[model samples]
Target chain A: MKYPQGVKRNQVNTPRADKEINYGQRGMTLEKDLDKTNQFYLDTKRAIIHKKPTPVQIVNVDYPSRKKAKITEAYFKVPSTSDYNGLYKGRYIDFEAKETRNKTRFPFINIHAHQVEHMRACHNQGGIVFIIVKFTVHDEVYLYPFEHFVKHWDAYLGNGRKSITYADIKAESILLPIKYNPRYDYLAAVDEFYFE
Target chain B: MKYPQGVKRNQVNTPRADKEINYGQRGMTLEKDLDKTNQFYLDTKRAIIHKKPTPVQIVNVDYPSRKKAKITEAYFKVPSTSDYNGLYKGRYIDFEAKETRNKTRFPFINIHAHQVEHMRACHNQGGIVFIIVKFTVHDEVYLYPFEHFVKHWDAYLGNGRKSITYADIKAESILLPIKYNPRYDYLAAVDEFYFE
Candidate 1:
């Protein structure tokens, strides 16, 4: 059955050419991969992470039938917090997923000011907060803690570099493993870095 | 300054007549009241609850300038889970808020099937789940635990009553107090009922 836009579906097909070129490789977008991983986590009763719905300013809606309400006019709003958050081992887990084509540095522009502030707020409230940085060219992912991001964020404003070098990320953050089913097992990195 | 459509602003003004008549009364919509309460919670370092932004499907966007990308066409999407979720004392808090015109009963139709399933999933993961019900006619609010809601929900599916009576709600749920700043201080009820 054809589903409406924004409905969650498991079997998302990537472009055929891309699929053929990247066979046996996790070539999907970071968000899609994370969604799969979160779904796997939920299904296995391990965690319950979810991407927050894209904020929208709705002005008009059309109801053609009792069962259907189609939004006719709306605008996307900037998110105030991270993209993903949920419960993990009875603790709140919040993080934003960002991908960079640059293999040497993760650009600071990939993140927003409000998101950093939100991470600080969550951390102050004793929640586990981090950022998932994906080096697309290198095909590597890292779970970088919010503290490290904040350090670089402040330094950039005070005569430091505009980006965090891959060397710094390697030194400070935990590397995530890419699996077939759960795709990006970042929570494993969380378990090692935060819990252990 | 003109703000974006969905940005939360504190100084929302209702009409003059409504303001005058409902003066000294919490006459704002359940959503507005909850937003105020959540803001209060955030400010006082009590909790970090946030209403999930309404989901939207973007069909088109126009970039008038390099920095300003305006969404030209989009549609709202139905939410799959509760309206509000956050952290309280290092525990996950998830809930939905609903208002009813009926003074006697709260119709189960106000909630969707997916929301019920979502609540169950959250509960299974050891998250604190509940529903905030507002009887607009009676000007009463209650924090009804998910367990209680589930009991009635299942009963309604199996030849039971179509709605939960106000008498039953009064006996089973914690009544929320309306205040000036926070508006609906439901967390106080949560503390007394769940943590106490």
Candidate 2:
């Protein structure tokens, strides 16, 4: 598959070579699914959640006209918080979502240190915080509450395994079933995990 | 009075000609003051608020090396939500801040319609929503509740005044007194307005 100009390989990971993957699921990334789900929720008047924009450090901007401002130089910044956060049912909701092709375990490398710190802070303050993990090879998704995710994170800090196995995630997290309008209904999992 | 290269006049409003303005209050913009205040709140474990990064639409990037991915083309997107949001005392807190030099009234031209809509959604979901207005000429700040601000905004939509008068704001909103560490103790005002 040809990528658009200036697009990097790792940035747009389209697993076209995986013939085992269903044809219907070719381009549905976790972020795109969540965006659709959030929009669905917004339209249904169920929740008001948003994925934060990619953080960038702007350096120089050029204005060719009075109404137009073009950014000429900028750099991406390491995000210091979760990618998704917003209000839900009179409570604060915060979470990070990741999709891993690895069949065995979800590694901790891509998840930043400050984001976990942020989750911990939010959790301590009584906000509903969690991590959503998707295994592309297995075609499975799980929503792990912050309370459980942090235990493994703490263990990892104390010289435990650097990643949590797929089995452990399956056992600890709520299995989010795929749906029509919302695609992956993670908030249903949230309701089952927290409110129920 | 000299601005950095490419900085627009209205973008960087530094009223050096205001002879009545104190010399000590030269460069303290509302955004800078709030950053300091949020940092202070974080350190004290009082709250976990953060300013959303300025949203930019990145069009082209040039990878100079393996480590450096330089953004070559981008543009600022008009923000659809509030600038600041977080969890405070188990409540979802959301707000926008604006500074104006107008002495008599705060105009609605600077505040966008979508931001007010976002605030309304948050307020409907029971989140603590507000707007912080700083009268640069009067050297005073006020935190106006979403319920109150929306009344004037809706009236404006109904062909009323395009702005809210200084007398109305001073009477209806909480006057946020400046302090040393937190600078603008708006949460104290929040507690007084909501919790009390």
Candidate 3:
């Protein structure tokens, strides 16, 4: 089987191949890094965060051959909340991970009102919600509190800045040690925030 | 301005109308229904729930026009959990909705192992995790609790019954009310389950 360019396929059990992913918008994808990170947490049993299933809204299928069926008509389903969620030491963990090349700032338009609403709901339920932001320019990663993200979400309405600056991120977000396994190391941040 | 057959021009403000949408195998796509349900909930303020954004592993994009871009080379990010989640009356709600035409029993293969783990974490954190099974043949929807799903899920490892029958659903699952706003009054079920 031929894999696409920039996609590194592991031989079943590769060690942190995803963690070492190049995020220069050419070598690897954001989801890969997040997946490796989740795997690290799961393996260590330190936290239980996960990316939810893809909602495939199947409209039609074509069976070109007897053994295989072709999904001729399928629309991506609209989900009901953030991309990643789970539990860590009995606290609900919910969040979204985003990557950008614009080193100056992280855009708020990447987030939607419904996502903000979902975060608030998780908060009401006593769950922790936040975002893992990666600045490929500086090769940096930060976890912005859900509260901060929500507070600044409505800023676009007031002619405020469109993105969260590195300084703002440093002030409002927790910097995670990018590891080979679970590339983002988000649980460490979680430990520092709610558990500690 | 030729649009792909699977894609639809949204009179309701869908951002990706120009993008190709493959609605595979069925006229009613689950994504659209889920979106409508979320919109209804948002408009009515019954329970704030929203689906997470699609985790696109964008490998390549073709700029057909300044206003339009077609994703040519992309692969699924191998998501780690389910599609829907939010809050209802101060409780975290996480679930995956699925459909089956099988008249006798629903198939378990439709679910993934990662989702099971994610549910376990949520359940451990006092979050309500479950599945929405829509028997398209009977036009009946069943909301099965995470415990029940998990129980049956584990059973698959020990001949625990591969699929839960519709009759079993009637006994174990909660029957949600159909309302004008969200259509599925799932919060009522939550109130009945968590409170009582």
Can you give the DockQ of every candidate in the order shown? Answer: 0.40, 0.68, 0.12
Candidate 2: segments with Cα more than 4 A from true spot: A1-28, B1-28
Candidate with better TM-score, 2 vs 3: 2
Considering only chain A, what is the TM-score of each predicted structure?
Answer: 0.84, 0.87, 0.79
Q: TM-scores of all models?
A: 0.83, 0.89, 0.67
lDDT of 1 by residue, B1-196 (tens): 7756533443354365765466425435788889989999988989989999977777787677655556666665678888899989888999999988787999988788888988898898888999999887678889999989899899888976789999999888999877798888998888987899
Error of model 1, residue A20, in angstroms: 14
What's the candidate order when arranged by decreasing lDDT? Answer: 2, 1, 3
Tell me the tens digit of each residue's lDDT in model 1 across A1-196.
Answer: 8667533453355465765566325435788999899999988989988999987777777777765566665666788889999999888899999988787999998688888888888988889999999887788899999888889988887985789999999899988888898998888888987899
- List native contact recovery per candidate, as a fraction of 1: 0.65, 0.87, 0.16
Q: What is the lDDT of residue A81 in candidate 3?
A: 70
Model 3 B-chain TM = 0.77
Could you give the interface RMSD of each candidate, to one decimal? 2.1, 0.6, 5.0
Q: What is the alpha-carbon lDDT for the whole of candidate 2?
A: 0.90
Please give the distance, in angstroms, between residue B108's alpha carbon in candidate 1 and its true position after superposition. Answer: 0.7
State which candidate has the highest lDDT. Answer: 2
